[model samples]
Target: MTTPIHITHVIVGLDVGGAERFLLRLIDAHRGNPQYAHRVISLTGKGTLGPQLEAQGIAVTALGMQSLRDTPRTYIRLKRALQAHRPDVLQCWMYYADLLGGLAGRRLGIKRILWGIRNSHFESGGTRLKRAVRRSCAIASRHLPWRIVCVADSALEVHARAGYDRSRMEVIHNGYDPETFTYSDTGRHRLRRELGIPPDSLVIGSLGRYSAAKDHHSFVQAADAAMRQRRGLYFMLVGRDLTRENQALARQIAATPHPERFLLLGQRSDVIDCLSAMDVFCLHSRTEGFPNALGEAMCAARPCITTDVGDARQLLGQGGRVVPAGDVPALTQAMIHMADLDATQLQAMGARARGRIADHYTMNHAVDRFESLYQTAMALPY
Candidate 1:
C-alpha cells in the first residue's frame, strides 16, 4: 500500500483570526482521507485553536517564540521537528512562517515548499519587524518556495508588485461550510434575547478585531447615523478587544445617539450562531484579503454590506451593497437602504447570497483545489 503524503503546516499562531480559522477548516476537511496526513507547528505557543485541532486528531507543536531574539533557538527547534516528521510538503502560512519555514525546510533539503500569503494591503499599520520580514520574503521568493498561494487575486497582485515571484503565485479563495454557517431562525432569536435586543429589531452586524484596519470607528459612526433615522435598528459587533473594557471603543459607543442599541460581543466561539442572528451583515474593513466573515454571513443567508476592500466586491457580487472604505456617509446610506428593504426583498437577496456560497465557495471545492495543488507539486522534479 502507498503511504499517505504527509504535509506539515507552519503558522505564526493558532488564534481565532481569518488565516488561522481557514487553516483549521482546511485541515479538518481532510479528516479520514487516505491521500493526506497533516500536522501543525506554531512559531508561538498554541493559541486558542490549538486544542480544537488536537481534538480533531491532528498533532500541534508550539515553539514558544516571543521576540526576534529567539530566532536562533526557534530555528533549531523547527529543524528538529521537521526532521522528526520528514514531511513531503512544507506549507507555511503568513509572512513570518513563510520566511522561517522556508529557510528551515530548505536546510533539510525539502523540495516542495509552499508559502501562503493572506494579506492584500501592507502599506499601512504593521510592526517594523513584520515589515522587515515581508521584505526578506520578497527577496527569497525567487528560489526558496516551489509555489506561493494567495487567498485572493488582490493579494497576489499586491505581493507581485512588492517584488515577490509573480510566476509562482496563484490565488485560492477561502471557503465556508454550509452545514456550519447556514441560516437558523432559532439561533437568530436566541442570540437576540441574550443580547437584550428586541426580536423584531433589524440588526446590522459586523465581525472583526478592534484595529485601524477594521475601521470599527466608521462602522459605529454609520450605525449611529442610520439608527437616528430608523427607530427599530440595532448593531451587533463581535471580535477581539471589542468589549466595554476597551476604553476607546467604549467611548465611541457612548458618543452615539442610542448607546443602548449597540451590543458588543468580544471574541465569541459561537460565530455561526452569531451570524444567524443578523438581518444584515457588514464588512467595514479599510483593507482585507478575502474576508471570511462576509462569506460566512452570506453562507448563513444574510444580506451583506461591504466596503470596496480586498475581493469583497467580487465575493458580495449582487447579493448586497458595496460602499467605499472609510466613507461614513456611504456606509450610513447603505445601512438605511437595507433597513428600508421589505422582508420579501431582504429574503430574496439573502437566498441569492447563500446560493452564491453554495455554488462557488464550498469547503469541498476548496479542499479539492488544495489536494490537486499538492499532487501537482509532488509530481515536480526535485
Candidate 2:
C-alpha cells in the first residue's frame, strides 16, 4: 500500500484578521517551495484570500459550515474531507480548528498533527466555561500523537500547565511582509487628508478588530488625556465594521472632551497607509498571542504605546511601551511620553521595531521556521 501522504493546513475561517493574514503568508511563502505539495482548507467558506491563493494555482476548499458549534455535522463534513485528502500531517489553528479538526484528522489516521495555540491566558481565564474549553483542548489533544505550536511564550506556558508535554510545544512568532507594509510619505499625506486631518496634526491610531479584549476603551481614555494637554492631536481607531459596541463606543467618545477630534475608521484595506499617517500607534488589548497590528505598525516605523499582553514586551522592547493591562493612568502616561519623544529618540525607537522583524519575525523567517519544523516532524518514525 502506498504510504498515506497527507500534509494539509486547516483553519477555521479566512476573515481579514491576523490569523487569516498569516494563512495567506504561509501559502505564499511555500507555494513554490519544492519541499511539499500543499493545500488549504477553510472550515468556513472561502475568505478574502481564497481568490488570491487560487490565483497562485493552489487548491482551496471551504467546508461551508456556519458555526463552530454546528458540530456533528461539522465533524461529519470534516471526516469526509479527511478521508478524501488522506493527509499524513494535519495542522490545526485556533480553537475550533484545534479541537474538532484535530480529532477528525486523527480519526482519519493522520500521524503528525500539530495544534496551533494562538490565544493568551488572560482571555482564557475569563470564565469557568472558557477555562473548561481550554481543558477540553488539553484533554482531546493528549489522545493523539501531536505537537503544539504557540505564537508566543505565554501561550506555550499555558499549554504546558494544562498538561501538554513541554517538549512537544514551541513558540513560533508570527510574521509580516515589509514589502507589503512599508511606509511612504505620499501614502501618509493621502491617508491623513482622506481622514480629514491636517499634516501637522499628531495622529494617534490603533488597529485590530475592536473586540472586548482589545480594550479600546483604555485607548479612548489615554487619547482623551493626551489631547487635553496637546491640542491638534487626533486619534483614529481602525479595524471594525459597524457593530453595536462600536456605536456604544462612539457615544462614549462623543461625550468626552474634544469629541470631534476622535475618529473611528472601520476596517481599512490600506492599513500601511493609515500607519504612515500616525505619529504614534497604540494597542490596549487585554491579551493576545502576538498582535499583528502592533508588529506591522512597528515595521512601518511608527512608535507604539501598548499594554503588556501576550508577547508585547518581548516584541516591542525599546520600540514601545508595555504597561499592565487596563491601567488607564499608566496607559495615559505612556501615550504622552511616546508622543513627546524627541525626533531622534522617536526615530531610533521606530528603527528598533523595524529591526526586530527583519531579524526574527518577517514572513520569510516565520515560513522558513514552519517549513523546517514540518520537514523535521515528518522525518520521525511513527
Candidate 3:
C-alpha cells in the first residue's frame, strides 16, 4: 500500500465554535482513511474540544499562548513543531493560524499550505487590536497559502474585497453528519419535558455565541414581539454566555412580557437534543460564514428562519424564511408567520429543510472535496 500523506492542522484555538466544530468533523472523516493522517496544533490555550480530540486518540498540541506578547515565542514553538512533524500538507484555520501557519510552512519549504476562512463579514464592533490583526491577515493572505478555503461564497467575496487573492480561493460550504443531527420525537419530548416546557407549546430556538455579530439582541426583540401577538410561544437560546446570569441577555429577557418562557441554556453538550425539541429554528446573526447551527437544525428536520447574511439563503433554499439582518420587525413577522402555520405546513417545511441538507450538505461530501483538494495541492510543483 502507498504511504499516507501527513496533514497537520493549525488553529487559533479548539474552542467549541463553528470552525472548531467543523474541524472535529473533518478529522473524524479521515479517522480510518489510509490516504491521510492528521494532527492538530492549537496556538492558544487548550479549549473544551481539545479533550474530545484526545479521547479519539488524535494528537493535539497546545502552545499555551497567553496574549499578543507571546507571539514571537509562539511562532518559534510552532515552527519547531512543524520541523519535527515534517508534514506533507499544512492546513491552517482562522486568521491568526493562517498567518502564522503559512509563514511556518513556508519557512520549512512545505509545498502544500491551505488556509481555512470561516467568516463572511467582519463587524465594526470588534476591538481595534482584532481589526488590526484581520487587516494584517488580509494583506498576508494574498501571498501566503497555496489555496484559501472559504466556508461560504459570501466569505470569498468579502475577503476578495478586503484584498485577499481571489485567484487562490475555493468555496466549500460547511457540512453536517445527518446521523448525529437527525430528528427524534423521543428527543423532542424528553428535552421539552426536562426544560419544563409544556408539550403543546411552540418552541423557537436560536444558537450562537452571545456577541454583537450574532445579534442575539435582535432574536430577543423578535421573540418578545412574536410572544406579544401569540401565547404558548417559548424561546430557547443556547450558546456561550447565553445564561440568565448574563446581564445583557438578562436585560433583553426582562424586557419581554413572558421572561419565564425564555430558556437560556449556556453552551450545551446536547445540542442535537436541544435542536430536536425546537419546532422552529432561527439564526439572527448580523454576519456568518456558513452557519453550522442552522444547517444542523435543518438536518434535525426543523423549520428555520434566518437573516439574509452569508450563505444562509443558499442553505435555506426555499426551505425556510430569510429576513434582513438586524431588522427586528421583519424577524418578528417571520416568527409570527411561522407560528401561524398549520401542523401539516410546518411538518412539510421541516421535511424540505432536511431534504436540502441531505441532498448537498453531507459531511461525506465535504470530506471528499477536501481530500481531492489535498491531493491536488500535493501534486503541484512547489
Candidate 4:
C-alpha cells in the first residue's frame, strides 16, 4: 500500500465561521480514506468546533494564542508542533494562518505548503491589525507555500489585485453533500410547526452571522417592504448575534410593518430543517468568497435569491434570482416577485437549483479535485 499523505491543517482558530466550517467539511469527507491522513492545529484556543472534531477521532492541537503580542511565543509553539508531527504538507487557512504556518513549514524544510483564501474582499470595517496581516500575507505569497487555494473565482481576482501571485492561485468552490442537505417534507413540516408559521404562508429566509457585511439591516428593510405589499409573506433569519437581544436588529424587526411575520431563529443546530421550511432562501452579504449557506439552501432545493456578491451569480446560474447588493428596493422587489410565483413555478425553480448543485458542486467533486491537486503538488520538484 502507498504511504498516506499526512496533511496538517493550521488555522487562526476553530471558531464557527465560514472558513472553520469549510475546514470541518473538507476533513470530514476524508474519513476512512487510505490516501490521506489529517490533523488540525489552532493558533488560538480550541473553539466550539474543536471538540466536535476531536469527537470524530481527529487530533486537534490548540496553541492558546491571545493577542498579537504573543506572536514570538506562538510562532515557537507552532514550529515545535510542526516538527513533532512532520506532516508531508502544511495547509494554512486564512491570512493570519498563512503567514504563520508558511514561515513555520519553510523553516522546517517542508516542501509542500498551501494557503487557503476564504474572502473575496477585505472587510469594510476590519481592524487595522487585520489589514496589516493581510498586507503581510500578500508580500509573503510571492515566496511562501507551493500553491494558494481560493474558494471562488472572485476571490482569485480580488487577491490578484491585492498583489497575491496569480500564477500560483487556484479556484475551488465549496461543495455540498446532498444526503446531508436535501429537501425533506418531514423537516419542512416540523420546522413550520415548531415556528408557528402558517401552512399557507410563504417564507423567505436568510442564513448568515449578523455583521455589517451580512447587511441584516438591509434584509429587514426589504422584508418589511415586501410584507407591507403582500400578506402571508414571512421572513426567517438564522445565524449568530441575530436574536432579539441584539438591540439594533430587534429595533429593525419591531419597526417592520409586519413584525409578527418575522422569525429570528438565532444560530440553530438543525439548519437543514430551517432551510427545508423556507419557500425561498436569500444571501444578502455585501462581501463573500463562496457562501456555504446559499449552496446548502440550494442543495435543500429551495428557490434562492442572492446579491451579486462573490461567486453567487456564478453559483445560482439560471437557478434563481440575483439582485444588486445593498439595494433594499431591488431586494424587496425580488422578494415580492418570488412570493408571487405559484407552487409549481417555485418547485420547478428549486428542483433546477438542486440539480445544478448535484451536477457541479457535490462534495465528491470537490474532494476529487483536492486529492488530484495534492498528488500533482507532491510530484513537483522543490
lDDT (CA) for every model shown? 0.91, 0.79, 0.90, 0.90
> Which stretches of candidate 1 lie above 4 Å from their native place?
none
Order the candidates by TM-score, highest first: 1, 3, 4, 2
TM-score of each: 0.98, 0.92, 0.97, 0.97
Between candidates 2 and 3, name the one with more favorable lDDT: 3
Extract clashing residue pairs from model 1.
Answer: none
For candidate 3, the 10 contiguous residues with the lowest summed lDDT are 121-130
Per-residue alpha-carbon lDDT of model 3 for 95-190, expressed as tens digits? Answer: 889989999888889869999989897645577877887888888887778899999999999988988888999899898888777888888889
Structure candidate 2, residue pairs in collision: 6-87, 6-88
lDDT-based ranking, best first? 1, 4, 3, 2
Candidate 4 — what's its lDDT?
Answer: 0.90
Q: How many clashes show up per model? A: 0, 2, 0, 0
lDDT of 1 by residue, 87-168 (tens): 9999999988999999999999998999999979765668888788899999999989999999999999999999999999
Off by over 4 Å in 2: 1-6, 122-130, 242-245
Root-mean-square deviation per candidate = 1.2, 2.7, 1.3, 1.4
